[model samples]
Target: MITQQRKLVTELPGPISKSLAQRRVAAVSSAVSGGSDIYVAGAEGAILLDVDGNQIIDFGSGIGVTSVGHSDPRVVAAVTEQAASFGHTCFMVNPYENYIELCEKIAEVTPGDFDKRSVLLNSGAEAVENAVKIARAYTGRQAVVVFDHAYHGRTNLTMAMTAKVSPYKDGFGPFAPEIYRVGMAYPYRWPTGPENCAEEAFADFVGQVHIQVGEQHVAAVVLEPIQGEGGFIVPAPGFLAKLVEWCHANGVVFIADEVQSGFCRTGAWFAVEHEGIVPDLITTAKALGGGLPIAAVTGRAEIMNAPVPGGLGGTFGGNPLSCAAALAAIETMEAEDLPGKARRIGEVLSARLTALATQFPQIGEVRGRGAMMAIEIIVPDGSKAPDAALTKAVVAACIRRGVAMLSCGSFGNVIRMLPPLVSDISLIEDAMDVLAEAFAEVLG
Candidate 1:
């Protein structure tokens, strides 16, 4: 008989973890992305074990980088076996089956009735860059449009694509030119609310584009299905569908940045599927590789064929080990019905967080799809004002209680939740209870 994994012991960053963190500070670059110094020695389904014999519940899933549980046996075995056979042949020089098989799987999964093709890359940034390149080549346009509060990637072109300041774009300057920004469908901050709010705001954004640069020069209009690092802002109803319609009418290629929203994170393989709209190009990364690093750009065959033979590819893109891991991960999601799992997870969490919002006025908003969730914290009143201080306090409280969480938002006022889809429901309940207790302690 199998037993449920439990997170035990206390003392937040155990002693050994604390020591290792100190060592990490000296050896690792300061530019790494992480909140604190929690050193994880081992992990399983939703549980993290520290070097000091302490266990903690993880809610971030390595920043949504791991959709499957930590160290999934199938993924581990496949990657290990593949690495032992042939680690790196560089697909550009020597072709491989794993890459082609993974691409076929992507074509089969990505939403669309058209003949779709996919290109593999090493990271989300590369996928975004490739998507933009393909769009320009196909449309013969020089401009791309992205929305405000959108989180694409961290590379130079993607840096320009992202809509936040501070940590992401503070010192990085002279970003890729010709990238335009428009208003995003943020219901919480949309003063009038999500009514005709979408129609009015989007129309205004369209007007701005036409007046500034004209639609004739645009290539693609890209937006995250659900803003990941931008407060998990799910667009209002009809917003995405309407955007696709407008793009089609104006001859602009429609692109969905699903780097964080695809692969069952949102109760669906791709969040855009929820609207039944087919994007010309869709980018996926985080969860695509199970736990390994792999990204892809899946789209219409004609558009994808725009780039010439030598136009796209990287040295390590679609590495054999990573491709094998992706194929195994895709199989796992299908066999386990993880998309259904995401739906169940969302129902349970939304119910819990909605109830907590009544008691805690700081929870200004709680919105997301499936497991890709977030809780926005504001001051006592539901004003546009940010309560980042309170947000930080709640996070500290959770860390103190042996639960690992990650925070994100335009103003750093949101507590994001992207727990592994394969995590135990009991573990999820445990984490939620701990989170409620943290809110209690911090707010009181």
Candidate 2:
């Protein structure tokens, strides 16, 4: 059932999927959203098999969750072995060795040479909220600063920190207060052009912090090194490093929300590594457990310990099975040099996407590092206006042609590609070909 080749024997969203969709409409809440109509029966490597037996190539990686790949053998084996031994027994009530070992691994792999500590949680939102809690506790500051086009998580506090409003925040208010958003060094959309983005953006961020929210009251300045949902917006070079220096000077805790760009997705263990900057706190999730739900806030020992003994914990924070899966995932990432693998994947994406951009003027930009990349679709008249409709059309064509795709960006014009790091060379080529063909069909 876990076939690597993409084979479409029937129409996409074929009979079985159509029936399942009808059932889902009847049984599931409209709030629980879905992007594609094809219901997956099984997935392996870069291929997803739908209930209708159509094989589709997956480029989204479940929005960057399945980095190692769906049903990775190492992850499956570890999870199974751990479940057979014991599945639950809260880490708070009864400590587990696996949980401690996982924390150790977190400290070892994360950036920063100083002693670090971690607290595990069930989701990225929880880890982000906990990071805020830790920073607030440590600095005794009430104000939190986040950048524009940054997405922390979906929790109430994180929703407040998030920059976008339509789907993630639309009816969900009154959000947590005392959270402030400032400018980001988005090169592609810089008003004064990308040349001045680094200096201008950083100055604007600092000025806003001092004018709108005093630096002394700021607990933490959180950001995604490479903005994910807002678009694969890699900041102008030296921007983050400069920001980090300012945060250090102002005694503001710098938190890197690596929820989407961590764990070898960005050609490095963490995206911040590219700029040679070390964050005071780093939140990680998505790829940590290979395919399981797990997240952690790893940071300086002094800051992470600021929270009281009982302040941080959940019923299933670090479940035994998730811990086992994480250990195996980390081992697999290391043994296979997934960071190196991500670089090679980036090369393939860069060559193909750049070629597509040259052909299709609608592709305003192609950005992102490693397996995490995106094409910003725009109008062809050189106005640089976001062409969200064209983006949707291209993505729909990909889905119909037996390839899974996803789109993101505050304006909804970025088609993001987050293929599994374990994807074979042939699979990457095939997926890119399908995407290019989709663009030609839609744009031409």
lDDT of each: 0.87, 0.92
lDDT of 1 by residue, 280-331 (tens): 9999998899889999999999999999998989899999999999988888
All candidates: TM-score: 0.97, 0.99
Model 2 off-target regions past 4 Å?
none
Collision pairs in model 1: none
lDDT of 2 by residue, 1-444 (tens): 577877898988799998888999989999987798999988988899898888898998988988888888899999999989999999999898999999999999999999999999999999999999999999999999998988888899999999999889999999999999999999998999999999999999989989999999999999999999999899999999998999899888999999999999999999999999999999998899888999999999999999988999999999999999999999989998989999999999999999988888889998999999999988878689998999999999999999899999989999999999988888889988998899889867
Q: Any idea what lDDT model 1 has? A: 0.87
Model 1 Cα shift for residue 283 (angstroms): 0.3
